[model samples]
Structures are given as structure tokens and as C-alpha cells.
Target: MISKSKVTAKLSVIDRFLPLWIFVAMGLGVALGRVYPAIGPALDAVKVGGVSLPIAIGLFWMMYPVLAKVRYGKLQSVSANGKLFGASLAFNWILGPILMFALAWLLLPDQPHYRTGLILIGLARCIAMVLIWNMLAKGSGEVAALLVALNSVFQILCYSVMGWFFITVVPTWLGAESTEFHVSMWEIAKSVLLFLGLPLVAGALTRVGFVRSRGEEWYEKKFLPKVGPAALLGLLYTIVLMFAMQGDKIVSLPFDVLRIALPLVLYFGIMFTSAFLLSKKLGFSYQETASLSFTAAGNNFELAIAVAIGLFGISSGEALAGVVGPLIEVPALLALVYLSLWLKDRLFPADVRANETAEPKDQATSLAQGGQLR
Candidate 1:
């Protein structure tokens, strides 16, 4: 059995480096965009048979380690945490999109495609990054894993619904042409399966094999450490290609970043605040509340970007918004992680302090007693 203290220590090391890894990836992505436009287009060759697909290479690798560690049985554990589950579902599905729509309308520039792109990005909730947040907050790994699975399901089902609503319904509300709002459900489903589903399945299988063959301890100590850097590198490589492909558009539309940044900031602020309040009212401990808050705040840019490219083409301002979302999100999330630590210290001070020195036998005895009660 993995002790909480050991898990906490390992997470501290990961927390120290995760922000840097994400920023490095973003920088590399930008550099790649600047250097090789054609190379960016070439990287999209991964497809099912001959049909071209929209897979985010970096996102896939980044999620691999987390998926590998997922205990399949944990899915069943979610029922025990219904309030937390309800809170995540409410924020991600209910409040999340509404806030995104409002943010896009209020903050994103007047450009139509760019506005749509921000909406798409916001509609997709964070699947992988939230896990990192949960880990940093010392949340239940089981709850985090369940959220990943739940978000993956919602991303596929709701992407088309939310996309069409934004494109069609929102335009009508603003007295624009609803007739021109066009995105096929088939295309959205295919993109979700190819980019999101494939990586998820691959990661799950990898996790199962690693646990069975090498055992959890070996997998945790040896394999898990390496997965983080590898995923970050993959994301960086993919981001570079994306930036390279869209470098010209990015440079030409200098204010695009400013425009995109607004909706993102608004969305993050609204979602984080809402989740934090709900967690408190629901009486969640500080750690769990932090996990809920960040999970609500983060967006799943990888899925959103893929769908944006598929729907609006890679050069569309919409796709650019999707790309920019992560650039803003990474640093913001790091800040939130620190904020979570601070909040945890204030509200639940016990979480931050080092454990008192205790003999191994005594610790084992305590754990055994607790297990017997359960």
C-alpha cells in the first residue's frame, strides 16, 4: 500500500517542475510555428486507415502516465462520492458552457470565428490537467480518475451540442444568420474518437499491463516519473508544429492574443469562484474543494483544438483561439495550484505540515486499525 506521506512527497517534486514543463512545451510550440509552417501540416498524418484525423500528439503523450496509473476499479468508487460527482458535473456541463458563452460575448474581439473558437475551447473541460491539479491539492486519486473518465464521455457527447448551440443559437440571439451555422455531428464524433478516445484507450491498456506485469510499486517509482517529462515533450513537439503551421496568422493578427485572453480569463475566474463556493457549501474539505475548483476552471484545449481545426480548418481564427487557450491556462493553473496550497494552509492547516515522526510498526498498526474499521 502506498502511504499518503510518500504520495505527498512525490507530488511535491512533480508540482515543482510541471509548470516549467508546460511553459517549455508552449515555447517550443511557438518556435516550431515560427520555423517550419509546412512541417506543422505534415505532422497531421496519424489517421485511421487513409482518412485524415485530428489527433494532438503532445496531449496524448501527456495523458499516458496518468492513464497508466488509473485503477479500473476506481470507476465504481465514484458512486460513494456523489456530492463531489454532482458538483463536477454541474460545473463542467451546466455552468461551464454558459460562463464560456458570456465570456466570449463580453471579452473576445468582434471577430466571429475567434469568438466561436473561444466558445469551443471553453465548452471542453480539462481532462488531463485537472488530474495534475487534483494531485497537487492532495485530492483523492480515485475522484480525480473518475472525473477524467466522466469528462472524456462528456467531451464527445457535448462537443457537437455546444458547438452547434454557439454557432446557431447564439448567432440567432445576436440576430445573425442561423442558416450559415454548419457543423456535421459525424465530423465532431470522429474527431473526438480519433483524438480523445484513441489516446484514452491506449493509456488505459498501458496502465492495466504495467500494474499486472511490473506491479504498482515498480510502476509508480520507475515508470510514472518518466511519463510526465515524456508527455510534456510530446505536447511541446505538437504545439511547435501547430504554431509553425499557424505562425503567419498569429503574427499578422497581433491583437488576437489580447482578444482571446479576455474570454479565457473570465471563464477561469467565473468557474473557479463558482466551484470554490459550491465546494464550501457542500462541506468538502479544503483539499477536495481545491480539486473541484481547479477541475472546473481548466479547459480541455487538446479536444477543443482538434474539433476547431476539423470544423473551421486549421487557419481559421477559431482554431487559433483554441491554441491560445492553453498558452494562457498553464501559468494560470500554476498560480491556482499555489493558491490552493495557500488556501489549504489557511483552511485546513494540517495538510501542509510535515507528518510527526513515528515508528514503522506504529504507523502500520494505525493503518491496520483504520482498515479493520472500514
Candidate 2:
């Protein structure tokens, strides 16, 4: 088995530079689109239900590695940290959505498409990347694993339904006439079925098949590394195609991207701070708080981008807003990871009776055992 130090070292390079890589890919995509105009659209024509087929393939790759790591069967572990679980659920589902909706409405009143994009992003919480962020912050891997598993399941269940309501029904209720463009509930369901359903099933099968056959250790440390940066690879591929189709907009109104990013930045910062404070108030341990904070803060940009393109077309403002989510989120999350660590030292000192034992319990110890301070 690999040591924790080795795992950290291995992941550091990719995690640290993810934002830089995304921006580089974005620029490359814009450049290619501007330079080779015909190639971008020809690829766009290869679509089934508004999403570019090429982009969908990349989206699958982006989503698959994330889904593969989730252990939906481990939900029994959830009762071990009911407080942690409840706080996370309340923040992610209740407060997070309302906050982002307010931000989108207050900030982008004039840009209805951008408002819709941000709302979609808000409805879809982070299922995959928060695991990495939680690990980087020295949070409990077990708690992080549980949070991610819960989020993944919740995402599949609620994303399409909440999405249909918010993206379609809620907007009209709020008196946003721009939704008159007419997106059917069937269309939204189809998009969800394609974007999230396929990768989710594929990842589940791969996880069960590999673990039952090769044992969990080899399936995780060995097989997982072999699929390094699957998220980034898929992200870069889709970014290239997305920008390829939207080159003209990038060239003409570069600042518009910044407008889309504004609400996202606010969303991340607000969620992180609110969750952090709530964790502290609830007397959670440093690591537990870190996991909770990151869970509440991070996003599932892969699903957002895929659904954006599928629902709004590859070149729509919605897709661009979805793309900018990661551009801002990567650096924002990296910075927050550091902040969480620093806070562990100062804001919430490690004085738990459990840790004073000088003999740490197993990583997966339940909260009832006083393990890792749920």
C-alpha cells in the first residue's frame, strides 16, 4: 500500500496547477477556433440532441474517473457522522442553492442566459473534485469519502428534477421572459440521461467489477493512477471544442467571461466561509470542518458543462458560463484548501482527547467511536 505522503506528493502536481492548465487549454481552444474556423463547426454538426458528439465523448471521460471513486454502497457509513452529514446536506441543498440563485439574479439581471447558467451550476453540487480538495486540506479521507458518496447519489436523484424546475419553471415564475425559447422537460431529462446517467453506470460497473476481482487496494492505488488526470483531459478536450465553436464571441466580447465568473466567485467564497463557520460552531474537529467546508464549496463543473452544451447548444452563453466555472473554481478551491489547513492551526486547534491517545484509530472509524471528530 502507498503511504499517505506518497499519495499527496503524487496528486500535488496536478492539483496545484489545475487552474493554469484550464486557462492554457481555454486559450489554445480560442486560438485554434480563430485559426481553423471550418474544423470547429464541422465537428459541431456531429451532434445528437444539441450536444456535440465529440464533446460528449470528452464529457464521459471527464465524468467517469470521478464517478468511479464513489462507493454508493458505503452509505451505511453516513450514520456514523450524522451531524457532519446533516450540516453538509443543509448547506449544499438548502443554503447553497438559495444563495447562488440570489447572486445570479442580483448580479446578472440584464443577462438572462448567464443567469440561467449560474443557476444550473448552483443546482449541481460537487460530487467528484471535492474529494481531492478535502484530501489536500488534510481532512479525514473517510468523512470526505462519505460526503462525496452522498453527494454523488443526491446529484443523480435531484439534479434532473431540480434542474427542470429551476431552469424551466422557476425562471418563468420569477418573471424572466427569456426562457420563452422553449426547452421541453423531455429535453432536460434526455440531457441528464446522456450526460450524467451514462458515466454514472459505467463508473459503478468498473468499480464493482474491479474491486470484486482484483481487491480494493489494487483497484484504487494501481488502476486509478493509470487513469491520471482523466478529468483534466476530458475538460481540455471539451474546452477546445466549446471555444472552437465560440471563437467569434471570445474575440468580440472577451470581458463577458468575467461577468459570468463574478457570481461564481461569490458563490464559492460564500459557501466556503458559511460552511467553515457552521462547522466551527457545531464543534467539529479541524479535519471534519475542512471536509465539510470543501464539500459545501466545491462544484461539479463537468456535469454543468455537459448539460450546458446539451441543453443550450455548444456555442451558447450558458456553455461559456459553464466553462468559466472551472477557470475560477480551480484557483479558488486551491487557495481555500490552504486556508483550511492554516485555519486548522489557528482558528481550531487540535486538542481533542481522541488525538492525545498517541495511537490513532483506523481512518474509517465511525463518529460514535470519537474518530476524526464528526
Candidate 3:
């Protein structure tokens, strides 16, 4: 078992490097986009049986570490915390979808594909990235792990249902064509599996391997640290490829990016505020509150992008909207991370000071607690 102190300590180091690494990745992505346009298409290829595998492999690699850390038992933990679970579920499913639909309808009236893209973005919930955010906020890793698992299950079921409703029922009710519903649903599911399922399986397997071989301690101390940088790098690499693939589209509609970004920004701001306020009202500790807040705020862009590409084509405005999500999100999350640290100082001043004072004592406590951390 991992101890909380060790978890916190590891996260502190991760918090320091995550931003710089992500920035480097973003820069590299821009360069890659400019230098290798042809390679971008090649990377997008998907293979099931001896064919070209999808470029979503990058997403898979990125999320594997975090998934591996999740314990199955933690799913029960999330269930037990019904209030938090319900709040998160309502935001991700009910409020998120409604807001996204409205935003897409309002912002991209001329671009139906882009509208669907926005809907996809809102429907997908955070899995891996939320883990990082939760950690930064000093939330319980166990709870974070639980939420990741629950969200993954929810996304798989709800994405298809909500997506179908969006493309079919909603559109038809509004006098739009529903002819594309079947085709769109098929494409969406395929994209979800390629982007989400594959990564989840790979990540879970990797987690099992690390736990078995490294004995959790080594896994925590060594393996997990490596994940933060890798994830940042992966994001950068993917974004660059996305830019290369969509540069012309983006250049053609420069103003559209801002339009696309609006709902996402609103969604983040609203969700974060709601989570923090609700968590506080529930009397959650700072760590738990921050975790709840961020988990609700973050979007799962990989799934959204894949679905956007499948539904609307790689060069479509929908895909472009999906790409912009992370461009806005990465910086926003970094800011949140800093804010979490600052909040720790203000709201939990004594705890923060005690944490500082007890830094050395943490290791001693870990030893005394028989090396159990979580």
C-alpha cells in the first residue's frame, strides 16, 4: 500500500515539472506540425488485425500509467461517497451535455460538424488528466482512482447514448436531418474504442505488471514519476500532429477557434466553481474539495478528438474544435494547480505549515506505518 505522505511528496515533484514539460511538448508539437504534414495522416491510421494501428496509440500510452495505479476496490470507495459521486455525475452527464449542446448550437450555427464536435467534447469525462489535477490539489489518490474508473465506465455507456440523442433525436426535433445518425453512431463508437478502450486496457495491464514486479513501492517511487513527463510529452506530440493535420483548417477560420473555445472556457469555469463551492458546503477537506472541483472541470479530449475525426473527418471543423479543447485546457489546468497550492496556504494555513514542518517526518511516519501510503 502507498502512504499518503509519499503520495503527496511525489506529487509535489510532479507539480514542479509538469508545466515546463507540457510547454516543451506544445512547442515541439508546433514544430512537428510545420515539418511533417504527411506524417500526420500516417499517424492517424487505425488497425485492428494486422493493419495500421490508429494514432490514438499515443493517447493510450499517455493514460496507461494512471490507469495502472487504479485499484479495483476503489470503485466501491466512490460508490460509498454517494453525494460526491452524484454531484460529479450530474455535472458530467446532465449539466455538461446541456451546456455543450447550447454552446454548440449558438456558436457554430453554420458548422453542424463542429457543433457535434462540441457535443462530443462535453460528453466525454476526464479520466487520466483528472488524476494529475486531483494529485495537484492534494486529493486522495484512492478517490481520484475511483473517479477515473467510474468516469470511464460512464463515458463508455453515456457517450453512445448521448451522442445518438444529439445526432438523431435532438436534431430531428429541431427540424434537422437525422439521416446521418446511424453512420455517426458507428463512427463514434469506433473512435471511442480506438482512443479510449485501447489505452485503458494497456494502462491497466501496465499497472498490473508494475505492481507485480516492482512491489508497489518501487512502482510508486520510480514508475509513477516517469508517467507525468511522458504524459506531458505525449500531449505535446499529439497536439503538434493535430496542428499539422488541421493547420489549414485553423488558418482558414482563425476566429472560429475563439468561438469554439467559448463553451469550453465557460464549462470549466462553471464546473470548477460549482465543485469547489459544493465541496466546501459539504465540509470536505481542502484536498478532497480540490479533487472534486478539478475532476468535474477537466475534459477528456482524446476521446472527443477521435470521435470528431471519425464523425466529421480529420479536416472538419468538429475536429478543430476538439483540438482546441486541450490548447485551452492545458494552460487552464496549470493555473488551477497553482491556485490549489495557493488555496492550501490560505484556507489550510496550519495544515500547510504543518506539512512543511513535517516534511522530514513524513518519511519517518511512512516507515513507522509499515510502508502503507494510501
Least accurate 10 contiguous residues by lDDT in model 1: 365-374
Report the lDDT tens digits of candidate 2 across residue range 1-374.
23445434434344535657767777887788788888777877777535678877877777676567666576466458788999989998888888888999899989878788888788778765575567556576556666766776677667777776776777778777645233445654555566666877887799899999999899866776566356556766766676676666657666987888888889999999989988999998887798889989987776676678767876788877886777678668877876776677577655333443443434322211111211
Full-model lDDT for every candidate: 0.65, 0.71, 0.65
Task: Give the winner by lDDT.
Answer: 2
Number of colliding residue pairs in each model? 6, 0, 7
lDDT of 1 by residue, 122-188 (tens): 7778776666556545555556667756776777677677777877887798886552445555655
| Candidate 2 to truth, TM | 0.70
Q: Which stretches of candidate 2 lie over 4 Å from their true place?
A: 1-19, 47-50, 66-74, 127-212, 216-221, 228-247, 285-291, 299-323, 344-374
Full candidate order by TM-score, most accurate first: 1, 3, 2
Worst lDDT run of 10 residues, candidate 2, spans 365-374
List residue ranges in candidate 3 displaced over 4 A.
Answer: 1-17, 47-55, 70-75, 171-179, 183-219, 222-229, 348-358, 361-374
Tens digit of lDDT per residue, candidate 3, span 221-323?
6766556455544555555555555555555576888888777787787778777777777877676677777878888876777667666776777788888
TM for every model, in the order presented, reads 0.79, 0.70, 0.77
- Model 2 has an lDDT value of 0.71
Q: Give lDDT for model 1.
A: 0.65
